[model samples]
Target: MMIRIRSRDGLERVSVDNPAATVAELKFAIESQLRVPVHAQILSTNQNLLLAKAPGDLNKFTDMLDPNARVSALGISHGSIVFLAYEGERTVAGPAFHPSGSFGKKMTMDDLIAKQMRITRQENPHCELVSFDRDAANAFQHYVNESLAFAVKRGGFMYGTVSEEGKVEVDFIYEPPQQGTEDNLILLRDPEEEKFVEAIALGLQMRKVGFIFTQTISQDKKDYTMSNAEVLQAVELHAEGDLKEWVTAVVKLEVNEDGGADVHFEAFQMSDMCVRLFKEGWFETEVKGEIDPKLSRMKKDVVVGGKDVTSVDNDFFLVVVKIFDHQGPLATTFPVENRRIPVSPGALRSHLDRSRNLPFVKRISDFHLLLFLSKYLDVNSDVPALSGCVRAQATVPEGYQLLIESMASAC
Candidate 1:
């Protein structure tokens, strides 16, 4: 069985053969797999433990204190996600950086640092409007609101189309492996899984259009719409995407006049200035508690509202985009990917059986379901062929249908 471990670093998995393994054994596995020393590590089922400010505060969480306690006794099992807090410097590997020659001219690193882009606010967003597929939006929100109870942050990549009028329509959301705390969201991206997603999107004639994330309940009381960390993450992705119309969507719970919690969605495009600053390495990435969450700290003073300052308000970097909804072509009923519960082969069989009365293409008109099949079938050929058939709503080849049914029965 595989158990997920989420820490400040990110989400990772460890395997154990026995379901009845002790908590001590689980810690040992974590130590070996994650490389945090057993003694320095503090494990808990409560996600709030990761928010502890001081070493003294950690004692309040006693959920996983007993080493001898059986993992199953504590309601942990395969696909269960546990929280981890550790003390000390744990090295996380980062991508290798290779600087390019300065436009074929020889310049010292010191000279390059003197020529960073000046920060500015953008009055208008490149994206005029952003629309969501009703079912896809509902599915993404329902899990975070009900199952997770808005206690932690969550994020996914929005996949769909961008129009010549600068309108962005999100048909689906592809969630990557990630760990979220009350204040932080760490996306542990998988290149292999993304390749499958890209292939399916290609067959469907769609592309990745935006990024979406949910804020925790704790963040509701904050003064700002987005924190500095959030601005950094959003802008980084915006820069990487290189899409002038790329949108960033936020999902949150707000209290209404009757004291009822309502799910609200807002869309924005990181201001052109924000993306430029992020790409040019002008914003400070390290977050400290002393710094205000509403403002982003900069490496040097930048002009904002005609004043030079070391920090800029996060709101200054966000340009609101209008929101709308539409009924997309694909269905979102199949179970979402990368949630706590594993999507088993039985799910495939059940889905096939439930939709048997419909056309073969209609039976498999789900992005997540296609994603599942993509893992087993050839990404370069078979995945695209199946997705192409679904896109056209054409009759599936008999041999392909037989192959799919055989896969479902193998469960």
Candidate 2:
């Protein structure tokens, strides 16, 4: 049986001859075949738990523990993709180089010049600038400000299209299912919601072009604008998207000298060199000391615009685009993803009754709350019925309203 193992270096496959091998045997196979030591190998079914020394201790679903337990019993089977987080460096066994042969010849002037050319940073971005739709930005920020109070982290995908002039316009935000803390955010995507978002993007003639995230206010004391973990996350997303114009935007509250907090928006795109290095596994995943912001910066001299490499720091970040806002096509609603909205069915009804002056669609304009209700409603009937009401700006039927209220009360 062959299983795919994914690590920072990318994916590889190893054959497990025994169908019911013990966890200890699996570790030995990885060490022998993959060259990752058993002591350093941290395996898990969940990507979020890949770094856990013993994932089972954090999640009941994780079974990569107990040296003697059968790998098959732990849900590892043929063709499965197991995530791996390992420490230390791995040595590859390959043919030795011979200077006498052309294949292993010493470097020449041309070789050095080509190497310099290949490793240079890309100065211009594919997209000129990224502009956020005012309504979309406001809708997302209002929820985070009012509910989350900027105490923790939050992230979402930006959906839009690039103009002919290379301008990227973000018109909507889709907040996936996630768990976030002050310094970390774990995306737990919902397949159903993703499908719905894809459909919406298709209708809007847009694509997922960027990622937006919030930095907790506590991080302001730090020197760097983006943390090491944040850099890792952004690079991974940028690489995964494979979009030349992919944007990474950060939203944070900067403290003024007067002690007032002002919201700041910063946008960046990972340089082409950064993406290539990440894919080539040039980065050291396990750092022994504090992360150096300059570690990823270019040390070699490469002339760009008549300036040496020192003129443009190789900090994995390229041009910073100016952000502008415009009207967009979405509204905020209840049950925001990742953040709990405290509302009972009674409370919902009370609010609706109090807002009788407003239209029905306006009263229930919280799309996040509608998504939560989607889980309980009949997909073929109730879900579409409610979606239609919102789309057409029509009043929801009394029966559907009663059903949602009852479901909310049951919760």
Candidate 3:
């Protein structure tokens, strides 16, 4: 279809190829063809609003759009879009008026608490598989209460999708361990790791919460290690079929009676060496030594030992991602620029994208992300504290943050 619109100044024509293309794509196409930044871009769809000045925050400006990540091909949920007006107070470059004659919904405190893009709502094909689990509401967000300093978890164990009632639904969902399917486990990479880390940081600061997860898939529970060193060498462990299932043994840790912790690790005795090497960070240590590269290489050989594994083989563990009760809070007052109705800063939006807007708004318009945390798990535990930017905005250095500890955490 060819589209031609006569503006007050002149005539404009555009050709459509993929009707399936979303408003986001159309806007991008127009921007690309016209060589204009989305900030000043004018788009008339269901309703109109200025495109937000932030990248990674697409939902705000194109809530009704189809989020198709061609590069990664991950389509975004349409309801995730939000209308963005360039200025914190208003949009001055909107020549196209919205049919609804309004600027869409205004963001609220609850929205901030939910860390939702008020402008965007999840689209209709909302995956009916997602049923509500009232039992775990916001339970997964509790991890944000950790001391507001730099912290990262291997993975998140808890979180729920945005609920229809506008509340966040948290849950401890489980999936059977893959007997031997590599595709069954979608392992995350560094960018995804950073994405979670950023969300964790913001959730702790703004929502007083985030998540930690360990899918059985995320762990390698293949019993590769053995209590007997001789067994590891004598028994060649290989699956019989072209699709071999490597069963890696795994273990959990507990705080022992003597105040020291007893880490009961599972796996072949050969792997014991590596697990021991992993201990320094989780405890309170400032510095760490690098493991000899030779050690890692040698260990891989010992495990594979010519095991005819398939083309795809990675670690998987069906551990839990849990959000503990927060011992902190999100900042109520961080600075925000009111230059326009939505004067979103690029840095701030980038952070939200990095965090996937995890049910908390730590920094809005270069503002702060805030959440409420009890220094203890509850009032019975202790006074509620705050984390992230709240601590940063405190006496701590601008680039640094103070800390807070939760009474109950890392479950």
Give me the candidate number with maximum lDDT: 1
lDDT of 1 by residue, 1-411 (tens): 899876665456889887899989999998887678899888888866766778899998888889999999889999887888887765543322112222223223343233223456677888779999999999999999999999999999999999999999999999999999999999999999999999999989889999999999999999999999999999988888768999999999999999999999999999887887788688899999899999999887665653557888898899999999999999998889999997976999999989989988999999999999899889999888888998899888998899888998987
Which of 1 and 2 is the better model by TM-score?
A: 1
**For candidate 3, lDDT tens digit of each residue in 246-310?**
12222233357896533232221112222322231111121113422111222111112223121
Question: How close to the true structure is residue 64 of candidate 1, measured as C-alpha lDDT?
Answer: 82
TM-score of 3: 0.18
Candidate 2 accuracy as lDDT: 0.68
What are the lDDT figures for the candidates, one per model? 0.86, 0.68, 0.27
Best by TM-score: 1
TM-score of each: 0.72, 0.57, 0.18
Q: Least accurate stretch of 10 residues (summed lDDT) in model 1? A: 95-104
Runs with alpha carbons beyond 4 Å of true place in candidate 3: 1-183, 188-211, 214-272, 276-326, 330-388, 392-411
Q: Candidate 1: count the clashes.
A: 0
Clashes of each: 0, 5, 75
- CA displacement after TM-score superposition, residue 59 of candidate 1 (Å): 70
- Total colliding residue pairs, candidate 2: 5
